[model samples]
Target: MDKESNRDEGQAGPVLTRRGFLGVAAAATAATAGFAAGARAATPGKDAKGDGGVLEVAIIGAGLAGLTAARDLQRSGCDSFIVLEARNRVGGRTLNHDLGKGYFTEAGGQWIGPGQTAIADLARELGVGTFPNLWQGKMSMVSGGACARIESKGGFDTDPRLTHELEEMAKLVPSGAPWKSPRAAEFDAMSLGEWLAKKNIPPEEQIGWATGIALSGGTAPARLSLLHWLSMINSADNIYERLEAVKEGAQETRISGGSQILSIKMAQALGDKVRLNWPVLRIENWQDGPVAIHTPNGVIRARNVIVALSPPLCNQITFDPPLPPRRREMQRRWPSFAPARKTAHVYKKAFWRDKGLNGWIFQPKGPVLWAYDNSPEDASFGVINAFVNVSALPSDPKAAEVELSRIYAQALGDEALHPVAYYDHDWGKADRWTLTCISPMPPGFLTTYGEALHPPAGRLIWSGTETADIWAGYMDGAVRSGHKAALNALHAMNERRA
Candidate 1:
């Protein structure tokens, strides 16, 4: 049997199936071979073909934003458009890959917040249901080399005084929305760490907030600017109902099948309008005519383009005539490191769930900074994902496993079961165009480029979770950007017709 077959039969841990890995690695080769086979013309040249002036639209990056743009175009009676995806798959950051045993887990962007209209709307249209995350079991805590479990009805107050101090700090800051505060700009410029220090919070309390938010949203607290956090407060300002929803005991939902199902269905619905293996290299725009997009295959023409990839990847495409000076500068100021790597380990079984552990362990100094049960509902399989703080894990996989094991033991109790397997992707090292997540403005976003980031400059329309009026860094934001951009494009098209 081949290695791929062997892996399916018994082998596990980190190694990709031969066919799966080879298929992704050899995408260029396959594309070239397919082109050579006369599958379709290798080059796309501008032609005044199609009856009634074809309004060709080219979208770069096929993640949530890109896919949404295509769907909206279809809804708007658009006939000609192309979705250029650089990755092997269409989901972009929300990919779900199989890990043997008929199970799969998210490669990136796992959670969906309630009331996020974009993703929620897509899910409703596609019939995908969501549940709240289950973190209700007895949780574990590790601090200053000591560990303990907070039983049911017990809060994570390893140090009562420290917890009180942190609570005080939370109280000092205006709850809900701080954006309109006269001190908003000044507050945004401050770092969470600096704020904590200024408030005289204890070290344990500081680390709790820092590490908690880092693992919670996959960002380090110190790295996030005060404005970013306040922006979150501002966005959630009217979210008092969110607490009520949580009080009802909810489970964070995954697509009944998986997020990939949504992507597959979206693509299937688009048919030929969506082009796979089309890697866009540059976008050249003319003031009067359609915009020209150059990919490795050739040049594509579009009436307008929607860029949905992360900020880092959007920077890769050189906009001919260059993006407006302010937009270019905003791109420079945007943070790239916020979307760091988030990893998980899948198990043959979810033994911890039965042990009254919610699979949440906070280890300040381990490769497995945090882990959760991202398993599908069958209860037959469970995946344990960890986010490694270190740039590179120890060369030895066993050592890495041991480090995770030790951390989980202390945090989840010494009896925490050993994981059957592990999975992670280095999103932090993803290229200039693609990183793990969107970086938030450090303290000076509001004072520097806050409002400027959202304004449209010429043909360019910015949409991502960060650019969303609500749920800025979540899947909802991505959906909102795409929906809004589509509306904006449709209005422009209508005006031209009039």
Candidate 2:
């Protein structure tokens, strides 16, 4: 009969039995009160003399996946857990750049759209609002010192026939395991670029495909596996447009207060259970219960450990007894090269909108991959966010800002040159923790190592966006993975008790 119980009773999607709902609600209330009282006194590193020393669960990484799992555990009456974060703050890849006066621009994973129910449900639970991405009016395409403006209706103007072909192929490739597809061997043998070449796609259309694929897959089509791309399309319900377009697609909506707020809210609710600046350096005895997780300060022993980091990030931690060869090799070879560079240019107003422009600019042969209007919902000021080629831009922040301003001016007129402020974030150089922003699987990756992705390595349960069955490399996927990991941990704990 509590707030959570009432909310669950009224909730639409998945329904829980009355008894089950009450049990969760009652447990959550008790756990919250307990955590509130003992949070300040609880020291994860310190060993308590007896069986009380070992925690029931220890989560590695304070990102969405780890935090979500922690939240679920608390709700399930399991309070003997701790969340360890490497960075000084939470939110993981979803970061926000303060734009002053209650405005923020996302520097990391930002958007959520249709079919992303996991993240959407989490946002709703956290009281985070959402707004549609600005995609109205004309989009400017700049190439070889020439700029062309084309009217847009949300989606790109790529060839429909080609998209249909990709959609058909996606149907055969399961989003959860592309390697299990009937024709996975054939599809994984070639790159997307190779397949497109045989289709004889026009030069202009190819640019659209390339830009979309590179932004989503984190690499050019030439290096991206065809099967991998199809798996992504399968996540969007076997619709290529849904995976790539902004209208009714994966890029449809922006989270209110930026995507980072979701993690910030969850962390706040978790209280001191979420520990920052505590990176797990080494995990010992992970093959069995009572695992010892070593950090800079000390070590925390736990009955179960949830590793909620990216597959590549897993390589950073030293695992005693070593992980299985397949999982170890997968972690060793996982694609970690896509540390995307993003920038935000602040303007006094959305001037481009006044000229029937959507503030979208794509330069096929230039430094910018795609630029769009990331202005605040209230239109207090205009902000242009872009994903730029790091190699093409100047390394210095000041020089890079000017160079990008020049490019914006060429497309949106002289007013674009005089931005009030600018901010840049190169994920690769920004932090040692974040190696890659997105996973761009190569031609033979999934078929080779996909089997090892989901299985738990002893007491270490893998949970991250990459391990998600659908929408891998996305925020929604991260949330789903978190839920699965928490459930897995709960089941394992029950089995141990039995």
Candidate 3:
């Protein structure tokens, strides 16, 4: 068996952040986590040359990256490309749970905000309007069996010294390639938790810092790489607020029809080019032109293939001749410890807004780690979306629902007592297409295998949110990677023709 094929065989599920134990859900939550689009609304290809006899590009996974590539190819007047998606639908990590009446609880990524211009511009082009997230009002904090509602405020109360120290360290790590930093090894060797221990942050302040870390990394602070954490800060332009703020921050805007609408619109524009249920089983002859992708339905051939899947999902597909040692190892070692569930509690109306509450909730320890208002723009109704930390929440469906509602009630008031409707989706249990909710990099992961995260293997290029130069794990990053990959594939094709 090839090293790549045999690498993750017999492994128990996906890689965990630490040992074979499950960690709690992240303290911080984001409505947006990915990008890539599809729409069958597009007209047929204009440039017959791009698709006449030979294909220009064949992309796998119709997430934002693949869709963007396909869109760009067609826009450049090239219709000689096709997008292959595994699921029966597009939008790899962006989905919405039905709630009827144009209301939806996003099952996948659904938010966008400042600094993520790639998706913003795309939304505008698609004619999709955006609405501000409902984050006005006091936030509720639950800890030690006591719940307290605090006024909405900017910036966390973490130690100023620690914040300053982190900012200084972040300067050393490049957002695109932290592994290339001069002190990469030093920073990468320690987990976020270990580094915090070394800093001797007092117990009182640790809770707040821990909350931010969990939210940012999508895993426990102890399990994340210090280097990876700092790299994100660098990507946010060295301002932590830009990275975590709900208003004027990364989680600032919501698409009019959920985040998946972008991909759906793109898919509509692409027409029949996107083949669903074509889960790629194997890829062969990638070193030369006319590469073949094997799926349960049939085989697809293309001059160039762009794999817009996360590393863990990439490991699921067997690559003929195998990927390089480093890429294989990177996939093998990549940790997917952030599998989580997002639930939405619906109400007759956003009563909290009337009470001057922001509809945000946080728990020091919880099955529902963090929550915020995800209601529709009209505010005719209420929707409180939250990250369910299984650690404290009951596993039983009914019990969990009751408990979650209780917590929400604590935050909003009696109005939260009984939601008119409830909706939730667990990404971990959903399917292999999206096994991990987020990639929480562990200590040394970047310095060791980060470089291999993006480099192409033969004609197969990697283009996922994780491969983005900036905002690597967000929707913006996904779009940027897709755009870059499309250009890269086109340039290579041109060079060959030349």
- Per TM-score, the best of the predicted structures is 2
Comparing 2 with 3 on lDDT, the higher-scoring candidate is 2
lDDT of 2 by residue, 169-198 (tens): 899999999999999999999999999999
Q: Candidate 1 on 51-109: residue-level lDDT in tens? A: 34444566676667777888998887776666776654566656554554444565556
Cα-based TM-score, every candidate: 0.80, 0.91, 0.88
Winner on lDDT (1 vs 3):
3
Which numbered prediction scores highest in lDDT against the true structure? 2
Q: In candidate 3, how many Å is residue 186 off? A: 0.9
lDDT of 2 at 300: 88
Q: Which lDDT tens digits does candidate 3 get at residues 106-213?
A: 656666767789989998898778877766668888766677877765434577677778888999899999999899999999898898888887776776787766
- Give the Cα RMSD of candidate 1: 6.9
The predicted structure with the larger TM-score, 1 or 2, is: 2
